[model samples]
Target: MRGGDLVVRVLKYLVSVAFLALPLAAQADELQEAPAPDAAAPVPSSSDTILVTATRLAIPVDQVPASLTVLDKPAIDRAQDIGVTELLLRTPGISISRNGGYGTTTALRIRGAESEQTVVVIDGVKLNDPSASSGGYNFANLLAGDASRIEVLRGPQSILWGSQAIGGVVNVVTALPAKTLEGSFDVEAGSHETVSARAAIGGKTGPLAWRLGGQAFTTDGISALAPAFGGKEADGYINRNVSGRAVIELAPGISADLRGYYASSQTEIDASTADSLEYSLNREFVGYAGINLDLLDGRFRNRIGYTYTDTDRDNFNPTRARAQTFDAAGHNRRLEYQGAFAIAEGWTLLAGAENERSRFRSASPPAALATPVPAPVRGGADITSFYGQLSAQPIGGLTLNAGLRHDDHDRFGGKWLFAAGGVLNLPTGTVLRASYGEGFKAPTLYQLFSEYGVASLAPERAKGWEAGAEQHLFDDKLVFGATWFQRKTRDQIIFNSCAATSTDALCFVPGNATTRRQGYYANVSRAEAHGIEAAAALKLGSFQLDGNYSWTVAEDRSPGANFGKWLPRRPRDTANGSVSYAWPFGLTTGAAIRWSGKTFDNAANTTVLDAYTLVDLRAEYALSPSLRLIGRVENLFDETYSTAIRYNALGRVFYAGLRGRF
Candidate 1:
């Protein structure tokens, strides 16, 4: 009866089992009075509408204005047997952190920000990693079965993405080409002896069309963390990945794409306590090419890009025999063109322009003459942005969205971001929304020239606002939503306290000499993140009840700090729910629950972590008509908690897989 009364008795037993399964999920949607003569038959797809391109404009996630989440492609082939951080932690303000297991180096945080402030795009290029000391994009060596869809955009998208997006954006779209001539393959074995395999092929000649795929995974991990100078043994780790992609339609609407990827991993670090036999090996390589054009008679659209990233880090220790290699490489080329003009009836017009350049280099391996030596850096940066957006519907159901962007930075020089949103369509299918935005982030190169034994760094900025409402009942089968937000930041590059003497040689520095970080940082701070989100989806027929609840009060008003604490890791309550079933013998069952509340880990909120709930179960069986067999049981009551706070999570896990189509 401790730990806040066991998180209030597990949130009162999940709100009393979601109100006792709400009358058997509302009597399984009534309509069973003898109607069985070969019933389950309906397959003619052409619109249940769920198309999204994360606002690079290709709307329809209920007309996206913001806060979008889509995981299509049959839910990524039914969660491909878990571990893309368990399918993005079952979504809902996403959060994932891993320091060990399944490829190490995995971190993603959204809504509470950080992880290079979120911006990872593939197929539209931009995959962070410039020696990623923080420009995040190590989706733990991403190989989620060559993702065909994954879009998550939540709050502050820097006005159509520019500059780390200030906490939002994750797009990985791939797989297209093959209207016919198909293929498929799979193999699996699980439970810590995990063996896996996947394959694919597609075609169409003359007028060209193509598709290709590949996958490989390995694991031996679990157990490795004990080195703030201590000891630990048998760290266990291994991972490998390979990928390839191609799509060409060339002509009649033009299309072209090429992709290649490589990954490598190894980890085991305790690095001290008389050197507990240390180890660390990390490697990554990526290449991409793109082109998409569809013109006028088709409403004009164009995209061109090139991207390459390389990373390598190797550290082996036998009592510091000194081997700590380093490598980081990046290249980006861009061209974008957009258009939409039906400027007469109900109006629509959007525009775009972008030019980018980035380069970086870092090298290390010259210290151990007993420490004290650092220097080896190279840098480059360029950005040119211009954007425009407008949408209108003068009357009928009213909707108007506006956007503007202008960014030019070679080094913190120009900024202008803006957005306006609206959605008001009420005739009982309610919806009324509002939005405002401006966000920015710039200054990294180890924050403008790295040097820790001698001090130097700076760059941070932001501004934002939002408002919303939505509802739909018994036709949309019950759905609801609400949102409110606000943000403010300015030159907030922190690490304060510098003013000391006593033969000051920067006072023999090595961090926190009462804090020393002010390389052009300004602090007139303010932060107020307000929120209230509610959702419901009920389509009873064979049982389906989805739910969501979020309540946040992220605060921080600075003068001397700690205005009302509660910023770091921002969690003031969150929830997610699910209850699904489909049984006519072919079976399909589901159950899910997730919750998080107490959060704080610095930023004056004073360390605290206690609030947790996670339960997941899934099942599917249909061994015919293109086969299917899936199973999942993650943390299903084996809960030993720790979604980060010394990090260690993965206690009750099981996965089964099988899929086929041809």
Candidate 2:
């Protein structure tokens, strides 16, 4: 389709969706503003809400023009999910493709963006693996053990977050101590012999606060490959993780904080051709230390921090002469200084400077131990960045924000970026927002210096804009929102295959340009994506309803055989809906449904992947003020589906657990 035609069609579709929201909102317009059915599930009002990820500062949600979703502890608990990625699927404009079951490779995408373009941040530390081809963080090992908050910022966000923010950012904040002494725990067991246990203890003293948490999970999972596609044995998974946080007040206006997270996992995997006795061991660690200083009567706040992340991965085949098949490690060290100041009565400033160093080592061993393994492949990169944003409320109910950033890469040189946005809040319970952002991502170490790498590849760049509106009715009992966004990316990186008969220089051996090779990395791709997201939440007396729907059109605009074709593995339409009832007593029951549209498995759009839907039922009963009994059945209908072609997805499963908060 032509670009102009596509835009017009998207606009019309958005208008229709916007109008559809009106009737949905009106259905619950009669709901009186009574006391919340569940105190823990209070209604949210963006006008008075504080969002921290918009600019790395606590600003009112109504002042931020970006499209975002916030899931707090209460919401997290209500979902009864064990994986962070699963919980995020409840939000708008998001999709994921997992190789098999839990503990397998998982890639998360936001608004049809490449999975590698999404940056994952945990406790102020960025998570990425330089050894990986895309250098993106894997979500398989990340579980919802002790997460207290999760926020997703959609669309281009590089103005604040440096690289890998082309798709967006997922910031996860764990628990912080609130009482002098407190603890929490959750444990569950279910089908496939799956079991998950978690525990945490924390305390806040006179001048210090500390918390530590741990979780262990195991599952006798389904076959890695679908039964219809091939025969396979049951593949199991095991994971253990620990996280901690500590804060100390050294003086009246000075403080220090430390945070750490570690996870180790073993997952059984299958070769593309057949099932095997191979397994992968992965370990991830993150550490951060920061000092905070408050000045000018708390008007100015400053923080200096250092963060480190390490990821180690290994694969083994018990049947082979040599147990180890592969080994790789990636490390990142970063230092940053950030400041937020209330410059004036209605103006605020957010600024930061960051320096990051990344390194990687990788190797694959032979089956025979006696045969010496090749030396590991090693590489590194450095990036220095400076950024600032100005937020002003020049008049009542009006907010304008603008930001600028510059990044200097040791290999890619320097690049400048700018973003601007505005928000208008009306007394009639309406919010209008518009934003434009630019994103940049340097080539990964593997993409730059590996055997398949090209030294002259250019960095990927993206430009995007979004406009949306949110409407609240009946005293926050009914809320509806819709957003339309468009993004264009250039010089996107992709692997290029070389024909055996072709004479491309990049397809030859290092010393012999005539010797044909397999493939090489190149910057010959361009893409365009446009989407619309709609969300609604309604609370009527003891019953609550929530739903989100998204329509995305992502296509390759490059000059090639795949031009104008849908991007691989991205569904064009997806929706999530749920309904819950809160009893007068201490009992709650809910049901959720998720539907994903069909998609292509390759860039050429020849391979088709069928669409599927899943249903889940959940119930929770409060035994005491500090404890709750929870039970849930996922994939309730025993639906057959596939997120990735030929890869098996989880089936029906049951779990019951107890949640304690003390």
User: How much is the lDDT of residue 130 in candidate 2?
Assistant: 92
lDDT of 1 by residue, 1-662 (tens): 12243334334543443354345334443321211000010111246766676677665555556666677766666545434556665666666656545655677766655667678776556667655445567676676665667788777777777777776788776665445677665656566565667667776667665666776666554554433323234465555666666657678767776776666766664422332455667776667666655543343344444556666666666554455644455444444444443334445555555656666666665537577435666666667676767777788887777888877776666778888777777888888777676777766554444433222333456666666777888888777676766566555454334444443444333444544432222234455566665666777687778767777676676666687687676677778787878799887888888888778766787777667898888887888867778777866897655544554455676767776766
What overall lDDT goes with each candidate model?
0.61, 0.85
Tens digit of per-residue lDDT, candidate 2, span 510-586: 66776776899999899999999999999999899999999999999999788999999999999999999989899
Full-model lDDT, candidate 1: 0.61
Number of clashing residue pairs, candidate 1: 2
Q: Which candidate is the best by TM-score?
A: 2
Alpha-carbon runs more than 4 Å astray in model 1: 1-89, 92-103, 107-134, 137-161, 164-316, 323-361, 366-374, 378-397, 411-471, 475-536, 539-544, 547-577, 580-590, 593-662
- The residue ranges of model 2 lying beyond 4 angstroms of the native Cα positions read 1-50, 368-371, 511-516
TM-score of each: 0.31, 0.92
Q: Give the clashing residue pairs of candidate 2, or none.
A: none
The superposed Cα distance between candidate 1 and the true structure at residue 128, in angstroms, equals 7.5
Give the range of the ten consecutive residues with the poorest summed lDDT in model 1.
34-43
